[model samples]
Target: MLIKFDVTNEEGDRLKMQYGQKVASKAFKMAALDAFDLYHKNQELHEVIDSQRTEIRRLRNIIEQARSSAAQLLEKTGQGDLIDG
Candidate 1:
């Protein structure tokens, strides 16, 4: 009974192994799971960062508009000259 299996490494190297060989399939599975978990975590973090960036931009626009409106109000109320000095 010859059972052949192929093991691939991160660099895409294929290693041929026979059945009943001392291979760490459990360890490989664990590493794969860890990598998948990290990938998902990074994706979530990126989404959160992107959302915060968008919110920050929106808030900055609102603040700029408010500042412009306040400056206009000051000018209309004759307080612009005081601020200019």
Candidate 2:
């Protein structure tokens, strides 16, 4: 496939530099494919990181809830000040 790009030069022949994408060789195609592969891999990694972040937040919330419940239990049993002292 042809991948044309813009080429602008003042005081130069317009015909010499076409102001659009043009045909690319096998090397260009390979490079483009490699770039695409990297992009997809990066996207996948980002998704995994985001998922891990969500889990971490959830776990943190659970830990906070457990701590709060434990404190309340201790207060009801008149043992809250034992730890504080």
Candidate that scores best on TM-score? 1
Tell me which residue pairs clash in candidate 1. none
Candidate 1 lDDT over 1-85, as tens digits, reads 3333365563222211322224446444445557888899999999999999999999999999999999999999989987778
| Model 1: CA > 4 A from native | 1-30
For model 2, what is the alpha-carbon lDDT of residue 40?
A: 96
Task: Report the C-alpha lDDT of model 2 over 1-85, residue by residue, as the tens digit.
Answer: 5665544443123433332324334334555567889899999999999999999999999999999999999999999888798
Which candidate achieves the best lDDT against the true structure? 2
Task: Give the C-alpha miss distance for residue 39 in model 1, angstroms.
Answer: 0.3
Cα distance off (Å), candidate 2, residue 33? 3.1
Candidate 1 structure, TM-score to reference: 0.62
Where in model 2 is the C-alpha error above 4 Å? 1-31
